[model samples]
Target: MRLVLVRHGQTDANVRRELDSVPPGAPLNELGLAQADAAGERLATHPVTSVHASRATRAQQTAAPIAAAHGLDVTVHDGVHEVFVGDLEGRSDREAREHFDTVYAAWWTGDLDAHLPGGESAHDLRARYLPVVERITDGVHGDVVLVSHGAAIRLAAAALLGDTAETLYVPNTGLVVLVADPAAPSGWALDHWDSAVPVPGDVTAGGTPR
Candidate 1:
C-alpha cells in the first residue's frame, strides 16, 4: 500500500507564524478550506481506500472532503498528533521561531534528544507518530491517507527516508507520497513529494512549522 501523507490546511496561527501545535488547535482559514477542497479534488482519480487524521480539529476538517470524496469516514488517531510545543505554545515572534528552528535543526544533526524547553524531543515524536502510520498502512491494501501537522510529518518522514527528508518542506495541503518498500529500512520509499515553497513576491506566503 502507498501512503499519502498530507499536512493539514492553513490556520490563522500559520499566517501569524505562531507555534500552535496543540490538540484541537486553530481551524482552517477561508483559503485553507478552499485548499482542502483542492486537495480532495487532486486525489479524485486515485483509488484511495482509507483515510486517517490526527486528533487536531484542523486535521479533521482537512480530512473531511477527502473522505467524503472517497465515500469513507475519517478515522481519528490520537497518537498521530503534532509534536507537542509545550512551553513554546502560542508564541509568535522572531525569537520564538528562531529558537524553534535552532532546536529543530539539531535533530537533523543526529540529536533526537534536542527539543524546546518543554516540547517533545525528536525521539519522542518518532516514537509516537511512526508506529501509528505503520499500523494503518499495514492493514490497508490500497492507498492510506493521513492528515497531520507539518513538523510531525517531516520528522516522521525523516526517520523513514533518512537524510532525504531532513530538509523536506511540506506546506499546508502538501502531499508526501510514500510507496511500500520491503527493501527500505522503514518499509517505505519516497515516490513523489509535493512542496509548496512560495514563489517570490507572493504575499500569501506564510511559513508552516515544518
Candidate 2:
C-alpha cells in the first residue's frame, strides 16, 4: 500500500504567506479550486482506494474532486489538520516568519521538540498527526490519499521515513508518496517527493517525483 499525502491547493492565506493553521481555515481561492481540479486529474491514474481530508475547508474542498473522480466519498478525519500555530495563528510579518522559520529549520536539524511561541512543535505535530496516518492507512489494500497542509506533511513525512528524509517545500497539490515497506521496521519508505530537489531515498522508487 502507498500512502499518498497531498497538500491542499492555494488559499488567500497561502498567497499572503500567513500561517493559517487552525480548522475551518481559509477556503480555496479560485486558482486553488482550479489547482484542485488539476490535481484530481493528475492523480486519477493512481490506484487510490480511499480519500481523506483534514478538517480545514480548503483540504476538504481540494479533496472533493479527487474523491469524485475515484468514485469514492471522502472521509473527514479529526486530528489530521495543520499543525496549530497558537499565538502565531494569523501573522505573516517578517518577525513571525523568521520565528517560524527558525523553529521549523530546527526540526529538520533533529530538534523536533522545538516549540512555536504558543503553537505546536514538530514533536507536537507528530503526536497528533501520525496516529491518524496509521489509522487511515492501516490494513489498506490499495493507495490512500490524504489532503492536508504543507508544513504538517513535511514534518510528518520526515518522521515516517526516518530523520534523514527531511526536505523543504510541499507545493500546493503536490504529493509525498510513501510506499509500504513491510520489510522495513517503519512499514513505509519514501517513494517520491513532488517538486523538491535533492529527493530523498534511492530516487529509483518511480512514479513521477517531479
Candidate 3:
C-alpha cells in the first residue's frame, strides 16, 4: 500500500513560531484553510481509498476537504498527533529552540531516547506512530492519506525508511509519500519526502533532498 503522510496546514502557533503539541491543537489560519483546499484538490486525483488524521483540530480540519472530495470520512487516530511538547507547549521559539535542537539532533543522530523536558522521546514517538502506519497499511490497497503533525511525520519517515533518509523540516501542508517494501527490512521505502505542492504563497516548497 502507498501511504501519503501530509503535515497539517499553517496554524497560528506556526506563524508565531511557538510550540503547540497537545490535544485539540490550534485550528487552521486563513492561509491554512486555502492550503488545505489546494491539498484536497491535488489529492482528489490520487487513488486514495482511506483518509486518516490525528485527533488534533488542525489535522482533522486539514483532512476534511480531502475526505469530502473522496466521499470518505476521516478516521481519527491518536498515534498521528504531534510530538508531545509537555512544558514547552505554547512557549516562545527562543525559549524552546535549545530544547528543540537538542532532542531533534539526537533523533537525526540515532539516539531515539532523547527528548525535551517532560516530552516524548523519539523512541516513544515511533512506538506509537509507526504502529499506526503499519496497522493502517496492512492488507490495504491503493493509496491512503494520513494527516498529522510536523515532528511526528518527519521522525516516523526516518524511522521507517532508515537512518539514511533525510529528516528535514516539513513545511506547513507538506507531503511525504511512502510505499511498502517487501525487500527492505524496515518494510517501507520513501517514494518522496516533504514533497512540494502548489498552494498559497505563504506555503513553502519542499521535497526529498537532492
Summarize candidate 1's per-residue lDDT along 1-210 as a digit string, tens digits.
899999988787777777887889988889889989999999878889999999899899999999999999999998888888777788876777777877777877788899777888889999999889878987678889999987788788878786555346677898998888889876778988877666422112323352
TM for candidate 1 is 0.92
Candidate 1 worst ten-residue window by lDDT: 199-208
My TM-score estimates for the predictions, one after another, are 0.92, 0.91, 0.90
Model 2 lDDT per residue over 87-204, tens place: 7788877787677777777777778889888888888889989999999988898889999877788888878877666565777788999999978677678999886442232111
User: Which pairs in model 3 have colliding backbones?
Assistant: none
User: How high is the CA lDDT of each candidate model?
Assistant: 0.81, 0.81, 0.79
What tens digits encode model 3's per-residue C-alpha lDDT throughout 1-210?
Answer: 899999888877666666778879788999899999999998998999999999899999999999999999999997878888777888755657567766777767778888778988888888899889888888999998999987788888888887667666677778889898899888788887764443433222221110
- Clash tally, candidates in order: 0, 0, 0
Candidate 1 — which pairs collide? Answer: none
Off by over 4 Å in 2: 196-210
